[model samples]
Target: MLYREAGQFKTSYAKDQAVFPIIQDRWFIALVLVVAYGVVPLVANEYWLQAVLIPFLIFALAAIGLNLLTGYAGQLSLGTGAFMAVGAYATYKITTVFPEINILVVFVMSGFVAAGVGIVFGLPSLRIKGFYLAVATLAAQFFILWLFNKVGWFYNDNPSGTITAPPRTVFGIMVAGPRATAEVRYFISLTFLVIFALLAKNLVRGRIGRSWMAIRDMDVAAEIIGIRPLQTKLLAFAISSFYCGVAGALYVFAYLGSAETEAFDLLQVSFPVLFMIIIGGLGSILGSILGAAFIILMPIFLTNAPALFNLPMPTDLSKHIEEIILGGLIVFLLIVEPKGFARLWQIAKEKLRRWPFPY
Candidate 1:
């Protein structure tokens, strides 16, 4: 009943086309933002801030990026981790060389660097697609990691071959490095996710997003309709990589602090993000957030559930069981709800809208 929009009337195009046209949705989004910005920081413990929240936000951002490319643009990519590595390494280099610059600017610059790399790698999308395109991106995953591993210049010729986030301050508060508090890092990550998610949500409703979707649906038909495949596909890759690059920077500076190339390996970064969109729902921004939260929380729950239930499960067996369960859940969800959680949420909302009497 509360979901009713009976009195809400839009007399203007902007009002009618608003992201949350329904007053109820606008209020709900506002409440969510208030809780996220105002309440979470005040009550969350260090462990929650560091282990769960920060990583969840970062992964959500990455999933959004991948969702834009793979889900929206119909370009299959397996090089997500590689792009993240590009962002991390780019941030390291930028901060090292120009410590005087703002950290926010450095993050944006790192995203551009990753965008350039993404464009270069995304070139093959014009020539190939589907499994072959995925294979090409997979090659990128291996090649980029290999390049980072072998290049002494990337890690500042350090024998460790590891990239570490230099101490950085935002508005006089340390948000990166060993001295940074978990709360500050969480704030930074949360801010980035909020901004990016809003931008992505709006962007998907605009012309460029429509072009990408058209290409995704049918490239030949899109071309017949005046959508340039090259520009559209490359632009998708560039924007997607930019989002991913920022996510990678957050992963390092705001979350991990220090990491090696192995941290962004295909299995660790790539597959998980792909799984996120697949499980979250393709072509849906809300799905990206839900998917990230699901992926991030599931493992933690699996590990902790045994102790909570006082079950005597060995560590090795527990890990195996976790793997089996995750795999089974993915398959089951695919069978039951192919569009993932976002679609289910949409259906529930429709039901609510038609409540009290069956049509």
Candidate 2:
């Protein structure tokens, strides 16, 4: 069989201890990266790139952050929307105040704001669990959004109840606001996604990851085993929010160029991202990306399907079909694989490993 690995052998410890022991898996990941960063831009039109791909990428990034907390660390959060807002508003202020800084710096610095807010909201997680902790996050959502709304200074006297991202240039190329090109933002978002994803992969595979997983599986057991519950939980919150912050910065500076109250609504946070991670898989980063893409593009396709096929779907019925598809996909995924897309991915990899050698 062309895909057989029966004869493969590892000699050195380092070679045997690698993340992907199989050569095919390593090549598969490399192929995916090449297609995502290289081949995609060549074929996709601006509408596809901006409307579908960008949203999918950024939201997947946010979902990955949330997955780290809710899925891995066992902290239930309903305030992901609030953390995203903190990032958006923080980016607005940083860029406007200096007006000379690199856009990359703003993306990174905005994480601090989200980190602070995440910590504050995370305080209640120590005392509460399940629905009570969820309620705590709800409080954070309302309070943080209110602070940004009523506080006129946060709006920068723009009189729009929003922040307009100024023109941003990366390495002397315009990459923000209306004048920015789709390709520029695509690359920027792609770069940040890659960097942070690598960091998260490392973090989750290391000691901190062990602690989070322990806490997730059972807090009491984790505590008895010497995992400090408070510190581990707080670190999850901080890192998770930091991911959201960078996503928020990109939302304004790269994609939208302006954001308002609706940008970080609970529905925006809980549904798109929360659902993405849940449907994709709780603990797998690849599942986050797959879920984000599936969630982001499905509705758009539903809306545009009629036009593409020359079929007449009433506007209202089209909307209903969109909802139906979403609901059905969730139900289908739940039924097909209770463990989620990650579990399916595992099954596929195993099948690849045992190709042409079925028991």
Candidate 3:
């Protein structure tokens, strides 16, 4: 009853087109923000912060990036891990070379580095698309990883070939490095996610976003209507890679603390993010968050389920079971709701608005 919009009347265009036009939705979002920003930090333990929340936020960002390209722009990319590597290595170099700069600035600059690389790779999108484009991007995945691994300069000629984030402070609060607390790191990642999410939301609602969608629906038709395919497609790639780059920076600095080329390997990084947007819903920001949480938490739940039942399950066996179950769930969701969880949520809301009616 409280969720009804019967009394809500939009008197202006701005109100009608507001992000959350319904009063209940705005309140719900506000409540969620309060809990995430205020309550979670105080109550969450090190295990929750380190093992779950931090990764979820980072992967959510990456998923959103992929969705922008594959979902909204209709440009298939299997090189997400490569772009993330660009960001991670770029951040490491920037912080080491220019120690006086702020860490936040380092992240943004790293994203631009990734954006430049994205534009180079995205040039191919002008000619080919669909499965062929995916193949081209897969090549990028291999090539970028090889470049980073074989190039000693990326790791500063370190024999270990590992890059570790140095301790950094923001407003006198330690947010990264060996001595940083989980709460601080969590807060930093959360802040970045919130800021970028809002930016993404606005971007998708603006003119550029509409151009991407037009190209996505049909390139020939969109071009006939004056939408430049090359410019729109490349813009999607740049923005997507930028988001992934920032995610890579956070994944290493805030979550991993130390990483190598293997940290952003194709299987571990790229495929999972692709799965996130597929299962969560393409072209939907909220779906990215939901998908990340589901992917990150599902394995943990599976590992603990046997323990709860007092069943003796070997680690290897449990892992296999988890993989099977995850695969099955993906198949089920694809078969039943190809648009994914976000679509289901939308349908539920529509039904709620017309409660007690057959329609």
Candidate 4:
């Protein structure tokens, strides 16, 4: 009964095409935002902010970027970490060279740098696709990391080979570096995620997004219908990389504060993000958030569950168990609901709309 929209009527095309056409969805989103910006900050402890909320927001952004390419554009990439690395290093370079510029501007510039790199790598997609395209991006994953690892200039010649986010402020409040508080960092990450997610939502609903979908469904048909494959595919790569880049900047500045190339390795960055899109739902923005949250929180739960239950499982055994469980769950979920958590959520909503008369 509560989920019914019987009285709501769309009188115009604009109303019909609204992002949240359902009043309940808009209200729910508003409530979520209010809690995230208002209540969470006031109540959350340091650990929750630093370890949970901040990482969830950052990873969700990255997952959304991947979803756009893999899910919407039908491009398979394994170089997510590489693109993120580009962003992190670019941000470090820009901030160091032009200290006068705002950090937020640096983030956007870093995204552009990653986009350029993405386009270069994406060029191979013109003639190759599917497994070949994935292999090409995998090559980028290794090559970019090697370049960053060997290049002393990229790290500003730091002997430790680590790039650190130097203290920066937004309107006189510290948001990065060692002195920055968790609340400030969380807020900054949340702000960025919210802004970019909105932009992504709109972008995916526009003309270019339609072109991407056309390409994804069938490139040959898309080309026959006047969609330029080269432009469509490359634009997907560029925008997707741009999102990953900004997420990388946030990962360093808002979360990690300092990181090495190893931090963005396949296991640490790429595969997990791919898993997020798979487990979250390939073509869904909300799925990215849900997948990220599940991936981030599940591990924490696994690690702490033994202690919480007063079980004396060994640390190494517990880790292996966690891996086994995660692997099993992924297989099980794939078999049961291949479209993922987002689809499950949609199904539940549909059922709710039917209520007691669900057929």
Candidate 5:
């Protein structure tokens, strides 16, 4: 298993502590990267790649951002949606203002903006922890969404209060707005996702990540061990926000083409992201991707199930069944494993590695 270092030799502490010491894990990751960055893009259908896969990647990136704060750092955040909006609007403004500027650059710029706002809201965590901190984050969720909706300038003077995606290209290739092709968008999204996810994985394994995990397990002990709670928490917020920002930019540029403030409402944006982290397994990057995929695909698969099989359409019945199934899955996962879906995955992988062996 990637998390284990069995039958491998380490001459020093550094080698022992390497992120992936086992040959099996290294090969497994190599194979995965090959499939993700190679095969999937080469052969996937446009509809599957665009509508479903791209959105799943975006949400997974967002979930990884949330996981860093809540799962690793032991702080709660309910306002990722708000931070994402900052990414969206800030990107919208920057791109529109500088028509000649590169669209890809806007993605990084949005992250910087969202990171600033994320830190401002994250400041409250210095004094509060647990539920109180989560409540404070909720204030941000509503306030920021409202701020954008009320401000006409943020919407670029659109009558419907939604910001429309302007047509843009990179290297003369269409990659933004409606005219962009699915394969083009998929590769772009995958490029960033792979880069950032690797960065996040490295972060958690490094000094910063250890500090967060220490803080999560026991703040008092971590403080005694010289981990600066305030400094570390703020860093987590900033970096976490950075990931959310990029994800937000992708949503508009690659997926939505245009977005409304309503896209980030508390019930729609905030809660679903929260559920993804919860269901995906907190503190695990791979879990975030898996969780986002499961949640995103559930409703889609449900709606299409009847049509896919040519079964009688029950309309309301299918919708209700989906709601029940979603709710039940969350409840069952929580009661069964409060640590989130990541833990279950850890167990599964361990079992796979230990197959044909006894405890």
Candidate 6:
């Protein structure tokens, strides 16, 4: 009954087109924001902020980036980690060269750098697609990582060959580097995620989004109807990389604080993010967050479940079990609900609205 929207009448086109048409949804979202910005920071300690929430937000942003391309635009990319590397390296270069600039601006500019590289790699999509396209992006993954590793300039010629985020402040508050507390890092990441997520939500609802979807659903038909495939597809690549680039910056600066090329490896970064969108739901924004949370928290739960139950499971054994369970869950979701968790959430809401009567 609480979820019912029976009397929330839309008197205008804007009301009808609102992001959250149901008053309940709007209130729920507001409450979530309140908790994220207000309560979480006040109560959460280093462990909660560092181990779970930070990574969850970062991966959610990355998953959203992948979904924009693979889900909405019907393009396959295996170079997400590469784009992220570009962002990280680009941000490092900019920060070192101009020490006085705001870190947030540097993050945005790094995304643009990654977007340029994405456009270059994305040219292959114009001619080839599906498995072939995946192969092309996979090559990008290897090549970009190699370039970063071999080039002394990217790492600033540090003997360790790893990049570290220099101390940075936002409005006099430390938010990056070792001196920045977990709470500060959490807030900065949360702010970026909220802003980018809103931007993505609006973008996917507007003309450009429609064009991408047109190409995704049926490129030949979309072109026939005047949607230029070249422009739409390239735009998707650019925007997707931009988001990934920002995510990469946050991953290093806000979460990890320091990282090397191995930090953005294919298995560690790319595949997991790809799985996030797949398990969460393609073409759905909420799915990205849900997927990231699930992926990030599942292992933690697995690691702790044995202790909670007083079982004598070894750590290595439990890790292997976690992998098995994750793979199984993916297969199960594929077989039973290919639309993924977001669809399940929508179905539940629909059912609640019609409770006490058969549809």
**Tens digit of lDDT per residue, candidate 2, span 96-207?**
8988989788889998889988987898888888889988899988998999999988879778799998887878899887898888889888888888887888889889
Residues 126-178, model 1: lDDT tens digits:
99999999999998899999999999899899888898888888789887889
Model 5 worst lDDT run, 10 consecutive residues: 1-10
Candidate 3 wrongly placed segments (more than 4 Å):
356-359
For residue 295, give model 6's deviation from the true position in Å.
Answer: 0.7
Task: Please identify model 1 stretches exceeding 4 Å from their true place.
Answer: none
Better of 2 and 6 by lDDT: 6
Clashing pairs in 2: none
Clashes of 5: 1
Off by over 4 Å in 2: 1-5
Superposed Cα deviation of residue 123, candidate 4 (Å):
0.9
What is the C-alpha lDDT profile of model 4 across 178-215, one tens digit per residue? 99999998988898899999888888899988899999
What TM-score does each of the candidates earn? 0.99, 0.96, 0.98, 0.98, 0.92, 0.98
**TM-score, predicted candidate 2 vs. hidden true structure:** 0.96
Winner by TM-score between candidate 6 and candidate 4: 4
Error of 3 at 313 (Å): 1.1
Which TM-score value belongs to model 5?
Answer: 0.92
Clashing residue pairs found in predicted model 3: none
Give the better candidate number (1 or 3) by TM-score: 1
